[model samples]
Target: MSPGTNVVIALAISSIVIVVISFRNKLVYRQRRELHGCEVPPSLPQLDPVFGLDLILSRFTSLKADRRNVSLLEQFRRHGNTFQSITFGRTTFFTIEPRNLQSVLSTDFLSWGVEPMRLFAFEPFIGKGIMCSDGAFWEHSRALIKPTFARTQIADLHLDDFGVHVERLIDLIPKDGSTFDLQPLFARLALDSSTEFLFGESVQTLAPDLTPSSAESFLEAYDYGQSCVGRRIQLPKFNFLTTDSRFWKSCQTAHEFVDQQIQKALLVTSKQKQDVDGRSRYILAQELLRQTHNLLDIRHQLLNIFLPAHEAIGVAMTNIFFNLARHPRIYTKLRNEILVADLKARTLTFERLKSLKYLQFVINETFRLNPTIGTNTRMALKDTILPTGGGPSGHGTSPILVRKGDSVVFGFYGLHRMPNVFGDDVDVFRPERWEKLRPAHWSYLPFGGGFRVCPGQQLALTEIGYCLVRMVQAFERVENRDPTMEFVEHYKITTESKNGAKVAMVPSHL
Candidate 1:
């Protein structure tokens, strides 16, 4: 053939290929839409592409400004519970509807996985431990550590340690008619108690005469690194191309301390197996070390547990106390319940502590109002359908389609406080809400839901309850010194007060 003829033939082939690719793209889009019992959820406010992007930016800017994360709650209220928002041309969603959450977290759980962003963000500080891990690694970590949180073990931990730190916490409070920030004090108590539970020795972060102070120790480094993980996530991807030197320094310092502990523990465990019987005992680190010989694995497990155990419990305690201070009637009611319970019981057992109906109700109300976990997120591993929340596009009950790459955030703030779910008084701080109301399935997930629910929840609840009981016993009154204090949470993996929980604790008048 002549060169001209060949050039014409090449143009024809290129056009055909281009047409085929376009057709294929359209086909894939249609297939994804039809997946998981229905097409993808409609954009918030049920808008088209251009309008949806604008809506997305409004929400994004609010978040970027560190304002409310559930900025779409209004949209959800107006339009529907499940809705999508586009960011950088990528679709993400929020599911506040109960059935949708149940599907995502429980029923169809295997269809989704932990969001990659969470893994990437947290792995540096905590490694591939349970909290950020998924699939096989998650299963292994969960299984290995599950037995360590046995009823008796956790009860023993609270019985022996949590009370001591609670006493320290009470002592640390200023009685000079002056206010003090309770966040750091609670953190010290939590750290000391958690360390004692985990490593068989309290770091004694609340100790009176520590020359250097706990703030100057490994706890400081650990806190810095944990918060840095949040910072790193917000930074642009490939941010390490110009990584923060301070972050690395904090990571190094934190890791070095944890590693030292691991090595020391290994040495001690090797020579001394303190098992009275041949069956072995369940101490957090020693038991896990006995199971897995990998130091890094143990470190990650230790850090994952230690960081949340201290930070989350501390945050929860502070917020609870903060709320209680503002509501003295509830505080007095709770204190009365504690005194009543203590008087009636022959001895305070785990069951007895847990059985304080009004006390448990107070804690429940605290969790409902301001969850420390704040939000839970998951990424779809495959095209899937949520069980409900499909009416946005006039496709009621047809099931919302979720594309493989889509992410969903379950915001507890709105979920727990929604009037439809919790009644008209949802926004009010009422411990009595739980008295008459039985929360629907996914509506109450303070510790999360499904197989991946926090294994340490019982332990954490016990610790909180343990502290509160001691606190009520020690003090006749709890009041917020800073009445101007409002609920503003700063987020890492968990949310905490921006400054601190400022409150006044008065000694028992009797």
Candidate 2:
């Protein structure tokens, strides 16, 4: 009796265990399939297999040395646009064609949203400012802040102030042959321009006696914030412990510096209000802080305004100078334009500066060739179809289902350089392309697109333009110290050149 009963009980227990294990396995399989939109082709190879994990790891490690965007563009050419892969711990949807880019940015923008790290990485410093916020919060921030950018003050103040700073920079440069790294010079110019326009204070970053290392703490902290954000994408659990992280330490230093400046600005604005002609130029920061008492919110908006303004202008200026030194004809034409304008006034006024069409052309040309933000990222809010039709890669109109939570990377660098849109001279630094740009709403987005387009575009353009005009007027000859030097791209929020551009400047007789 005991033997028969024992054998039957053991068999029943084993059967139950087998059934439970099978059920658990099925659920796990379903979840993974759902994550990839369930429609991912079975034949589509894993990203690691195509681009070996070792190589991908190496690329990220040597980010400072590699021309990553250019290399990725080359890979897109070889693999074709619309390739599927995973890198930095998320699935990536890369496209180089205009049609595909338009579909992602304009036609089906609502389907995509910002990934977690992309939005929250700067939370320790910026909070949920417009740059990081999505949905309603983003809308509210946009409403409150966009008007400030739209104000005539932004246009008038920025151009005039930037021109003054550029003149100061020129006066400082030695008249005789002296070689210097123009990269840091441009960086300083950008930082000063942005700071003056945003906070009504000048750091005099471009002064000849001013050392770039003075702001090294702030720049390092800024870089740390970007790295932390990128790292968050791969390590979600790290968020809970970020305060103890080195990244957080760097962020704290940046926040403390900003807070001091903000407090100082507030005090000055208060004093200014006491005067009869009482006018405060720190309107952007003042208004933003007054509307929201949240410290993180204030920090976020401040950094949002500061970081992009610094990075985009810095990179664009570097590229412009690089291109000008490389192409003598373009440089000469640009200088001639500045010379003609200088004849009208000792100092270029904001209104007079706008008439320099060639300067604008050169800036636009640099943007096309070297976009500051190499890639645009968005997450799927719900399972939706991408409007992109099949390319040469045969990813046809089968309604590409994007599962909720998957990240879709709209490749801006790839799109900007696409042959179909920009033509055969795609890689060339030709400002003339913009003359024929015509109105292609979503196709060309250096400042991003849709509701999220940069509100600071006008300010950025003004700052860059003023600096360029002043530089041209000041220098009789600008020569590239390292014409053969290649720009190596590294990702830390905005793309930065690994080694700065070195150039020689000589004062003009005019």
**TM-scores of the candidates in the order shown:** 0.88, 0.82
Q: Which run of 10 residues does model 1 get worst, by summed lDDT?
A: 271-280
Error of 2 at 352 (Å): 4.7
lDDT of each: 0.73, 0.67
Which portions of model 1 show Cα errors greater than 4 Å? 1-23, 31-40, 45-66, 70-72, 151-153, 211-215, 234-236, 240-242, 269-282, 343-346, 393-396
- Count of residue pairs whose backbone atoms collide, per candidate: 0, 2
* Winning model by lDDT: 1
Quote the positional error of residue 364 for candidate 2 in Å.
1.2
Which residue pairs clash in candidate 1? none
Q: Per-residue lDDT for 1-510 in model 2, tens only?
A: 699999999999999999899798657655754564444421224456533465456555555455657766866766666666655434556665556566566677777666354655657655677777677877777887787777765565445456767777667666667777777667767767766666657667666676555366776776677766655543444444466577777777788767766776667636223213443344466777667776556666778778777887888888888778767788888888777655432345555566777777788777777788887677777666565533335344333555566666666787777777778888877876666675365667789876778888877776777677767877777787875655666576777665566678877787
Off by over 4 Å in 2: 1-65, 86-91, 207-216, 227-246, 269-282, 343-354, 391-398, 435-439
